[model samples]
Target: MKHGFKQRLFIVAGILLVVCAAVWLVISAISDNMRYFVSPSEIQAGIAPEGHTLRVGGLVVAGSVRRIAKGLTVRFEVTDNASTIPVVYTGILPDLFREGQGVVATGKLRADGIFVAGEVLAKHDENYMPREVQEALNKAEGAVDVGNAMRKSAGGSL
Candidate 1:
């Protein structure tokens, strides 16, 4: 009976070890592949990691879109009202892509500070906007509102 109990305990221990290792591996893999969703303001603030995959959302700055002389490459700027980020993309843009509209781009930021997008997504309709872009705009507007309120309370101009 003692020998049988010892064998069962070892077997259970081995199984537990395998489970733990598997969990660890899954966590590691997820962390490695995770991409951050951020705003152009955050990128301008120097918090977003450069050369790492990131999803940035904001409005396409008016008149910022330009096609390259050669190739399908296009360059534009996305803004969160407070800051703007230049983006470079090499593929076809979405049909809804245009200035003064919401956009979300996924890619890495080069050391030169331009976002090199692997994919660019645009808002589908006039009334619809990407959640991230809306959030970023809301956050910016909130900040501006607070600033105005503070100035008023402090007897300063808006």
Candidate 2:
């Protein structure tokens, strides 16, 4: 009876260990591969990991978009008022994508600060403002308020 009980205990412990390992594997796979969206200034501020993938959204800078080799490769710039980020994509862009319009790109940041896009998404309408652009504007407004406070403290006039 003692030997049988010991064998059963070992079996239960082994099953629990395998279950734990499987759960860990699933969680790691889900979290490590997921990507988040950011903006041009956020990239400039170093908010993302250099080697990891992410999405960025902003307006395509006017006259900064160009097509090459029969549309096999395209280059463009995404910008908020604070800054702009150059992007390169090798795939066909969405029809709605154009200069002075909102766009979202999925990719990783290269060492030189350009967004190496794997996918390009364009805004669907004129009334659309990309989420990245909205966030950047909020941040900029906050900075302006802080600057105003400092200037007021110094007795400066606008």
Top-lDDT candidate index: 1
Backbone clashes in model 2, listed as residue pairs: none
Q: Each prediction's Cα lDDT score?
A: 0.81, 0.76
Residue-by-residue lDDT tens digits, candidate 1, 1-158: 99999999999999999999999999999987898989988988899998779999877776688999979999999877778899999999999787776789999999888999999998776567667777777787443332332234334522
TM-score winner: 2
Error in Å for residue 118 of model 1: 1.4
lDDT of 2 by residue, 1-158 (tens): 99999999999999999999999999999988888877787888888788888888766776788888675789998866567899999987899877766678999899999889999988776555566655654564333332233234324431
Candidate 1: the clashing residue pairs are: none
Candidate 1 has its poorest 10 consecutive residues by lDDT at: 145-154
